[model samples]
Structures are given as structure tokens and as C-alpha cells.
Target: MQNFLNLCNAVIGEDYVLHEPAKQAPYLQDWRQRATGQCLAVLRPANTEQVAQLVKLCAEYQVPIVPQGGNTGLVLGSIPDQSGTAVVMSLQRLNKIREIDTANSTITVDAGCLLEAIQIAAEQADFLFPLSLASEGSCTIGGNLSTNAGGTAVLRYGNTRELCLGLEVVTADGDIWHGLRGLRKDNSGYDLRDLLIGAEGTLGIITGAVLKLYPKPISQGTAFIAINSIVQAVALLHLAKQQCHANLTGFELINQLSLELVHQHFPQYQRIFQQARRFYVLLELSTYDNEQVTKQLLEHLITTAIEHGLVEDAVVANSIAQAKNCWALRESISAAQAKEGKNIKHDISIPISQIPNFVQDTDAALQLAFPASRMVTFGHLGDGNLHYNVSPPCGTDQDSFLEHHAEINRIVHDKTDQFGGSISAEHGIGTLKKQELLRYKSPVEIKLMRAIKQALDPHNIMNPGKIL
Candidate 1:
């Protein structure tokens, strides 16, 4: 182990190799503090070449390698196990914007670059990088690509996989695959880029990428609509898609309880409507038309929905500040929930058509099992993903309620499976959901995944014990 550390130190300089326990403490723990891992060392390489060198040394030593970016991942994918046998290869030093090809409408960036940085760079170039996440400020592009993250703009631009045209990865054997060509179409061979994008670093380390960019919208319309139920929200989504077509950028579903919790914690953000409704939709539209045209289109859509009895009331933002405030309310749900108390969070996705039924049946079943438990359900309704969570009954011991974690997850996940949904929508399955994956996935599916893992990572060193 000392020899291995010396070699890694030689490769990237001893200053970048952190072997001391105190120096590695920050990277060893997860963002949510759910778990803290042990690592032989935390290796910070400044560029792709140094990364390749360190990976080669690890491969030669048969040492496990955990590739981490930003360390903002919800899953345990970036952290090593408790055995302390792995080296955490931090990608933060490789943060750089390589190029922005205006003609190609693509941005070539190092994987360690911040998501918000990329967005801002694209905006400066008069283009738009539309992958918008709540953690955009902290999350790295490499982590986003590894997870194939879906965010608020997924309804318009798709997930990170869709936004990326190519990737530069350090393979398990420490070989660099510089396949970062900003091409829109290339059917010559197997799509390795797509394969690595969502592999959660289990296959290889994503060092850089060429991501797709779009023309900046002339104007955007934001509206908050009060609806009766998830069914109405789902209906409103369909109607908005029809009326707004490709211009529809975001459609988030927020239940009344979620809003009340937000207001309870953040009293400054007042409710948009005086009359309380069961659910609300934070809808947005990005169009090439001017502000007046965009406003008119939004008003027409809301008026039509009201006439059809899908919405009770609606408030369209009159200015950019108003629109941001509306989004702030949607974004504050998780923080507010945290302030309220501990809760069980499930990031699940169901088919759009079945979401209403899934919610109705799941809520009833949960009520029957754990009476009076509050459901904090809201998510990107346009994309069929829901951050369905649960809070303990009034005055119930929060910690005691958490003891039912396994049972609650089983109920929710089993119902998700029954409705043909995915247990993980945007968050990838690390060690946290590995067992659940085994239960939900078919034998053949699991077999194929394992085979791929074995084929790509014959030594099982690249982020082992992750999804498979």
C-alpha cells in the first residue's frame, strides 16, 4: 500500500495525494451524511493525462478506484467501501471549459466543470445549456453525465445523456478514449459514449464531454396553477403540451402539503393563491416569440384549462423576479421538509398515463399501513418522475417512524413496480439500492448487466459494488 501511494504521488505530485485520515475525511463522507467511507487516499489529478497515469497505477496494483466529481451525488456511487482498500480519484482539478463551437452548437468541457458554469458559459455565447438541477451550483458535469441526470429542463432538452454528444473516458485499464467529437450523427460503430454516460463510473471515468446546446429563447412564460388533484395536474400537463408544443420547458407538480410545509419553514414566500387547492403546477414555457406573445400564449392556455375545469386558479408571473420567486417556491420543498422533520424520500417514476392511479392507490395503501402519515409528493410531472416522500404522523417519534424505512420502501417500490415504474428516476443506484435492484429486475436483465460489468471491468476495480 505504501508503494502504491508513492507511485500515485509520483504521478500527480505528493501534494495532490492525500493519504492522511484527516485530509481525506471530507471526501470520505457522503453529502447527505448517510454514510462515511474509508479510502486508501484521495488522489487529485490536474488533467486527463494525470488521471490516466493514476488509473494505470491503480490497475497495475489491482487497487480499487472510485471516481468522484463534486462529491454532490445522493447515491453512494462516488465513495469507497469501509474496507479502506480503494483510492478516491477526485476530478475537481480538471475543471475547465475546453471549447464552445458555435457552428456545431456544442460545448466541449472537462467533466469536473460545474453544471452552472457550463450553463453560464453557454449563455455568454448566446446559446443555452438546458440541463437545470436544484444542485446545479454544486454538482459537477461528470457526475451529472455519469448519472444521466434529469432536471427541470428535461421536458424540453432531455436528460444529460441526450444533451451529450461525446465523452472522453479513462477506461478500466487506464487507457484514454478521446472520442469527444461534436457530431450529431455517427452510426459507424457501437455507441460507447452512451454506454459510459449512465454507467455511474462502474465502467470508466468520464474526464470530459461534448454536450449539445440550443438557441437562447427570446422569452419565457412562467405560471403557477392551482389544481384539485394529481389527476388534474396530469391533465393540465397534457393540455399544456398540446397548446405549447415543443415550447413547454417545465411542468412541476406540487401538492398542497408540500406548499404548506414550504410556507411553514419559509414564511417569506407567500402562497400564490388565497384559496387552497389540493395540488399546484409550476408550468413554464420558453419560446422564440417576444414577451408579450409568450404572455398571451400562457394566458390562453390557462384560460382554456380553467374552462375545461382542470385548474381552479392560476397566477402567471408578470416579470422575471416573479418567475424566479415561483421557481424558488418549487425548489424550497426539500429544504422546508428538512426543517419540518426527518422523512423518507423516494425518487420514483411512473408512466405519465398511470401517475394519477399510482398516486391514488399508493396514498391509500400507505394510509392503511401507517395511518395519518403525511405524503409530500411532487416532481417533474412532464417527465413522469416524482419525489414522493413521507413524513411521520403528528407527534410520532421521528426516529421511531424511520424504523419502518424498509417496510415503507417495500410498499412504495412494490407499488411502483406494479405500475411499471422505475425505483430510481434520476438518482442512480449505488450500494443503497443494489438489493432493491435485484428484487425488481428480472434474471435476464441482471445477467446482462453483470456480463457487461465483467466485460468492461474485468478486474472489478472501477467503482465496484455500484448498480450491478
Candidate 2:
């Protein structure tokens, strides 16, 4: 460990290597408050070359290397194991917006650049980099790309995997793969850029990427509506899609429990609707028309939905400020839940058609198994992903409730498997979902994943014990 630390310090200077326990403590834990681990040192590399060199040195010593970005991941992919044999490679220093080509509609950015920074940059250029999330302010593009993050915008723009054009990666063997072309169409032999996108840092370390950008919407509108059930929410989504078409940018589902959590934790947000239903849909409309057309269209859609019995009540944001406020409520769900108490989170996805049944069955099963638990469910219904979380009952001790995490996971994940859904959707199978992945995946699928890992990282040093 001492020798490795000395080598890292020599390569990147003493200021970049953190060995003290106090300074390393923050990097050892994940955002979920789970899986704290120990590492010899945290190394900060400034550029792709530095990253390549660090990987080479670690590979030479047969030491495990964990590539981390922003450290906002729900999974323990970035945290080292308790063995203290791994080195945490922090990519924060590599942040740099290389270029923004308005003509090609692409933005070249280093992996360490925060998602919000990219969004702001695109906005400044009068363009849109559509990959967004609640953690956009802190989560890095590298992490987003690594996890292939799905956000509210995925209904229209697609996930991180679809938004990326090219990549610059540091392979496990210390070689750099510079495929950062801003081309729209490339019929190449293999889409290597995608292979590393959601690999959870097991295949390689993403240094930078060329991301796709779209024309900024000239007009925007937002609507918050209360629905009777998940089935009604799905029905409304289908209706909205048919009516609004491309203007329907976002369609999210929020439950009453989640809304109450937000209202209780974030008092600044004014609850718009008087009555609370079982579920709510926060729908957004955007178009090229820079006049009142967008608002008129949104209002008409809401009115139609109400007449069809799809929506009980609705409120359309009157101004840009109101739209932002409405979004704040949706974005605050995760944080509000955190402030309320400890809970088990599952980011799962099912077929659009099966969502209603999946939610009903899972909620019923969890209720039967853990009678006192509260299910705070909400997510991008348009994309079939739901943040189905199980919180401890009111006035109950969080620690005691969390003790049944394993059993709770079995119940939730088993239900997901039964419905042909994924245990993990947007989040990758980092350490958190490794066992679930093994159990859910077919033997052939697991074999293919292992074969790829062995081929790319024969020593099993790059993010060891991850995905596979």
C-alpha cells in the first residue's frame, strides 16, 4: 500500500493523492447510505493520459482499480471493498467542456463534467442536451454514461446511451480508445462506445464523450393532474401521446405518499391541488411555436383528459417560474424521502403494458409482507421505470425497519422477476444489485457477461466484483 501510494503521488503529485482517513471517509460510502468500504488511497487523475498511466500501474501490480465520478451513485460501484486492496480513481479533475458545435449539434465534454453543467452549456448555446436527472447538479456525465441513466426526458430524447455520439475511454490495458467523432451516422464494425456506456466501469474507464444535442424548444408548458389509479395514469399517458405527439416531452407518475413526503419535508413548495388522488401525472409539452400555441395545446389536452375521466383535476403552469416550481416538486421526491427516514429503494422497469399489474401486485405483496411499511412509488411512467421505495411506518424506528432489508429485497425483487421486469433499470448492477442480477439473469446471459469481462479485463482488476 505504501509503495502504491508513493507511485501515485509521484505520478500525479502529492496534492492529488489522499491517504488520510478523514479525507477519504466521504469517498468510501455511496449515496444510499449503504456499503462503506476501505481503500489504500484515492487518486485524482487530471487527464486521459494520466488515467491511462494510473490504470497501467495498477494493472502491473495486480491491484484493483475503481473508477469514480461525482460519487453520487446509488450502487456501491464507486466505493472500494472492505479488503482495502483497491484504489479509488477520482475523475473530478478531468472536467472540461472541450467544444460545442452548433452546426453538428454535438457537445464534447470530459467525463468529470457535471450533468447540470452540460445542460447549462447547451442552454447558453440555444440547444438542449436532454439527459437530465434529480442528481444532475452533482452527478457527472461519466457516471451517467456508465449507468446509462434514464431521466424524465427519456420519453422523448432517450437515455444516456442514445444521447451519446462518441467516447474517449481508457481501456483496462492502459490504452486509450479515441473514438470521439461527432458524426451522426457511423456504420462501424462494432459500437464499442456503447459497450462501455453501461458496463459499470468493469470494461473500461470513460474519459470523455461527444454527446448529442437538440434544438431548444421555443415554447414550453407543464400540467399537474390527479389520477385515480396506476391503470388510469397509463391510459392517460397513451391518450396524451396520441393527442400531443412530439410535443409531449415528459410524462411522470407521482403517488400520494410521495407527494405527502415532499410536502412534509419541503414546506417551501405550495401544493397546487386541493384533493389528493392515488396517483398524479406531471406532464410537459414543448414545441417550436414561440407563442400561446403550446399553452393552448396543453390546456386542451388536460381538458380532454378530464372529460374522458382520465384526469380528475389538473393545473397548468401559467409562467416559466410556475413550470420550474412544478418540476421542483417532482425532483424533490428522492430528497424528501431521505429526510423522512430510511427506506429500501428499487429502480425497476417493466413493459409499458405490464406496469399497472406490476405496481398493483408488488404493492399488495409488500403490504402483506410488511404491513406497517409505506410504499412511496413514483417515476417516468412514459418510460416504464418506477422508483418503488418501501419506507418504515410512521413513528417506527428506522434502524429496526431496515434490519429486514434482505427479506424485503427478496419480496420486491421476486415480484419484479415474476412480471418479467428488471430488478435494476436505470441504475446499473453495481455491488448493490450483483446478487439480484445473478439470480435474475439466465445462465447464458451471465456467461456472456463474464466472457466479456475476462476478455477486456483478464486480471479482473478493473472494478472487481462488480456487474459480474
Best by lDDT: 1
Which digits, one per residue and each the tens of the lDDT, describe model 2 over residues 1-468?
A: 678678888889999899889999888988877679999889999999999999999988888999999999987888999999899999999899999998899999999999999999999999999888999999999999999999999999999999999999999999999999988789978889889999989999999999999999898999999888988898898988999898899999999999998999999998978787888999998899964998889888888888888888888999878889889999999999999978999999988889999888888888898897899999999999989999998898999999999998998889888888999889888888899899999999999988989999999988998887
TM-scores vs. true structure, each candidate: 0.99, 0.98
RMSD of every candidate to native, in Å, equals 0.9, 1.1
For all candidates in order, the CA lDDT equals 0.93, 0.91
Which pairs clash (backbone N, Cα, C closer than 3 Å) in model 1? none
RMSD of 1: 0.9
Report the C-alpha lDDT of model 1 over 1-468, residue by residue, as the tens digit.
Answer: 899999888888999999788999989998778799999899999999999999999999999999999888877888999999999999999889999999999999999999999999999999999999889999999999999999998998899999999899999999999999999899989999999988999999999999999999999999999988888888888899999999999999999999999988999986798888899999999999999999999999999998999989899999898999899999999889988998998999999999999999999999999999999999999999999999999899999999999999999999999999999999999888999999999999999999989999999999988997
Error of 1 at 231 (Å): 1.2
Candidate that would win on TM-score: 1
Q: How accurate locally is residue 94 in candidate 1, as Cα lDDT from 0 to 100?
A: 88
10 residues in a row with least lDDT, candidate 1: 268-277
